[model samples]
Target: MPDLNPQTVAALLPATCRKVFVAYSGGLDSTVLLDLCVGLPAFAGKIVAVYVDHGLQAESAGWGEHCRRQAERLGVDFELLTVDARASNGESPEAAAREARYRALRQLLAVDDVILLAQHREDQMETLLLQLFRGAGVSGLAGMPIASAFGRGQLLRPLLEVAKVDIQRYAQTHGLHWVEDPSNQSSDFDRNYLRNEILPVLKQRWPALDKTVARSAKHCGDAAQMIEAWAEQTLPTVFDPTDGSFNIADLSAITATQLNCLLRYWLRRMGLKPPSQAVLQTLVEQLVCGRCDATAQVCIQGSIIRKYREKLYCIPEQCLQKEVQTNPWIQEQERIILSNGYVLSRSIASAGLSKNLWNNAEVTVEPRRGGEKLKLPGRAGHHFLKKLYQEAGVPPWERDIRPLIYLDGRLAAVAGLWVAEWAWLSEADGCYQLDWRASESM
Candidate 1:
């Protein structure tokens, strides 16, 4: 029997978290979860069900309708969401279907709402094994969190410790009718292969296979937490604050394991799509481990991480409408205004003095280049842009894309590099510096 009885699940639900939405797919596991929810006191007046119709198999729509009908029979509110499951870039068809299904469900929930799923211990074992096969770190091996943030609300998997056979038994006990997905036995999907073949073989060898895998996943989860804590401390050391954001130098100093955690953590913090292990490793190896002067970039999600001039620059996938002032004196200089509320603007304000000085000045913005020398007003010597960056303590990777300022073919200011001694806004100086990049957020 599944230990995740309605009573056990009921005990874990907080008093305030009564409203719940079950991800019902007409499967036996989901059907049992629906039955369990109805019997729980925490779901007395607030239990809604959702059946996502991923137009994958020909009969998926019928299955969704069946789930809705079953929910009505159980006296639960039901909503059906239909989605087009499409995949690209070497993604599996099954994965695309699941992604579309979850994306539809994500849109249905409000920020304060909670979503329930029927992921069991077996699913956890499968997820961990898959992550391991893909060279994932501890966080991936940790298995899906029992409850984690998703979209605006939260996702809860109360059956993480329960067995699938128990869910089947529950359906049999209650005479609950559910649809059997033919794909589960088709041996086409990775999960199906594991469920029908690999898992049974492993279980036959070790009677407590599910339990052991779950334990291992939990251990990985704990170890991952410790590694994250260490990275938190190490990040600020190599990560520069000059741009009011984290720099890639911090990542360059990290080991592959640390790099993996930090990249995923950064993505989670920004609420962006995470890249696969291969993408991450390529980023580390090609971008971080490449030549100091080589321009390298790896686009993940909608953002591009580019290393140039020994510093890394993050830009949107689309060409952002930036404030670019065309100057007749210099063909290369394009005064870019950062009207976009980027974090770097805050760093510019820390220099004190008037507001929006960079906005007022027709700043000359151009890409950094070699052989570009800056001759300060009072300084007798001329300094190369590259050397100036090093002397200013900018990371080698950041110098290339830092956006050097050129006044009449003479370097005046670096967008994020440094304001030339001649261009610095002193106590008496009214001229300020800022990026002219427009808001692409819209």
Candidate 2:
């Protein structure tokens, strides 16, 4: 490949994107990108350099300062963001740092703003190999796209196809100084191990390994897109938007390969992490063949797959932790924050509970203590909360935190879902309607 220059890099910029922010890590790869952007007429007065300090290494702060000074030397705007990159329960340090870096960059970008990174052909090949080793399907094997919609903006990799040797040559030709992260030399991480040990040997055997591997990744990406299109066609048959769950019977009818594709696509749509193959297979088994009475569940990362009443739910574990404590209701307070991360509010309606009831009775919101029954309007007899939830198709996990509003120590309404017949206003002048807003659902 010809040496990457400012003109070649500028030619790769998308015509629709005017604002550009390069994720300048003060490393060789990013240094080349930053220098190219500084000289590009298209990026003139439209470029900003952002350095994220992951705070993983002791010298991260100093590195950030170096990047800021470099940005100043180039006469470009600069911003620094500090974040904690400590690994969580099931996350690796490298993954943690990467997640934190992108999240910080996202906050600095606006809706149409483009953030550029400096991943080259070799990096792409390494990612493909890593995903293959992990038994990833097409999505992972496809590697990174040049451009994609990201948080509030788009992420672009202008040098994704550029060779690492070309980048190094460009940096040296420009007499630019860049930082060399010590972590890159540490083979303790999987990617570093591949870079330090595996790729060199492979490249010696096959001089064009980077370009060839990239071609294979592109093929995988094409196949992935085709599979995604197929999955989109199958979605309408298996999805139930009414309750935000999948229809087990419909999903079970599909082949295992189809099921796996749909499952990954659905999880991605919901902004949840895709489960590993083992966890996904377990989820499929529970969803398709588990006993009707069984409450089969599989937890992956921070999300949980729950099967209830023949429907599969991708519930965030944080939602389940919202165990609301009993609290008295204040009519004067327009909005009440529930312990379960929901909000209860009072709205006036032409027809609802009698306004007189609000003034005459003291109301409080509390969690159901069990055996609580409500005589809903138009229903023959009072019914237990459990029976009502079951009949209404409410998941068992949600039953515990569902608010039960009381009027003068008597059950008045099942917050926003139903109101007791006794609490119903007669031919009164006005009425007060209860409105509940939960994070996921009522």
Candidate 3:
């Protein structure tokens, strides 16, 4: 409504973008954006409209039809993407629907093709309030970003500065009709509760409530930037992408508060929400202070923090499959009848310390857990596998999931992580048997 010209939108675009993709939901905000894009003279590129059907609402199909008709009327290409909105545990219907909707849109967008969305000032204000209620930190309180990655594409919210009234007015001025979602009026959803109830009360006292909340978000955004800069400086020491895990000792050197902030901050940078403060505290404590006999594990909201070989690893437990196939990379196990009677194939790998090991060791592959010991060639009696791992400088994170190969009942070798002094077989024959393969399984 504030005279949105093609110049404004064009200014935000990259040099490579000649086409704009609008996520046309047939809602008031998107309708206004679509109308403005069609009317604005400065926009020279083609405008493509996309409507995603989450299949959660009964009227979603009808809404899709409406968007298609509107896009056709505006003389633009229209795409309707349908997706299933399966409910995930700890996720509400609204959240799941939204997640599915954007996933569909992201798939449709080309990396260089710009995506214009209608997330206005009110949405920002509501987001700020929601973050506050959820006890979010600076980064979480910073709210939605104006430009961010969506799948392989980038989503640009050009209307972020626009108000709800202005958006509605623009749509009305253009004689645009948008489908109204009834759920928006129901207070059952958190977003609706703010839009209809709390925000109105706040607006009564402070008329420019949305603007005020958005300003707070901007300040939080700046603070988050500062924290990010600090984290960038400190993160390199405790965490490394090359190692694919964190250095536990380096992490332990910091205070609990700093560790909590840095670890959560790091996770957020990876596009994962940080675990709760309680979970993070337990994770750091257990992982850092783990004994040789103890296995430390911390279950966060979306992932699990596990300790192995003195290193800390974050794994998405919810996404992990129950069983893994046998290969060099994964650990597999089964009890098999042998001359020794019921020998377990504790673990397997494609190769080992020496090629001759596979030929002479008669290795059987299987997974092993719970205080397993190994017999090194020079050392007599069984060496506690945990102690051997510690001596080998294996980080705690890697030790938990590290694969070990067992021959008969004695631990023959540790995969990729450590080798038993006794497990090594010296042979004059060329073409040595491989023990640990390049893959993850045995």
Per-prediction TM-score, please? Answer: 0.71, 0.91, 0.76
Clash count of each predicted structure: 17, 0, 46
RMSD to the native, candidate 3? 6.5
lDDT for each residue of candidate 2 in 1-442, tens digit (9 for 90 to 100): 6668776667667766757999999999999999998988766888899999887888888999999999999999998889988999989998999999988988877866889999999999999999999998888999999888887888888899999889988888889999989989999999999999999999899999999999999999999889989988888787876655777765547887888888887877667767788878888777657776545788876777788877788777766764456687666887787665678888777766767887788978888778998898888998999999989878888787678888899888887788888888745458888887555542
Off by over 4 Å in 2: 1-3, 11-18, 251-253, 321-324, 425-429, 440-442
Q: What is the C-alpha local distance difference test score of candidate 2?
A: 0.83
Which 10-residue window in model 1 sums to the lowest lDDT? 339-348
Instruction: Choose 1 or 2, whichever is better by TM-score.
Output: 2
Give me the displacement of residue 66 in model 2, in angstroms: 2.7
lDDT of 3 by residue, 305-401 (tens): 6666556666655323221222232222233322212122323334334545444454544454657877666678877877877797665544554
Candidate 1 structure, TM-score to reference: 0.71
Q: Can you tell me which runs of candidate 1 are displaced by over 4 Å?
A: 1-4, 241-291, 294-303, 308-310, 319-442
For all candidates in order, the CA lDDT equals 0.69, 0.83, 0.69
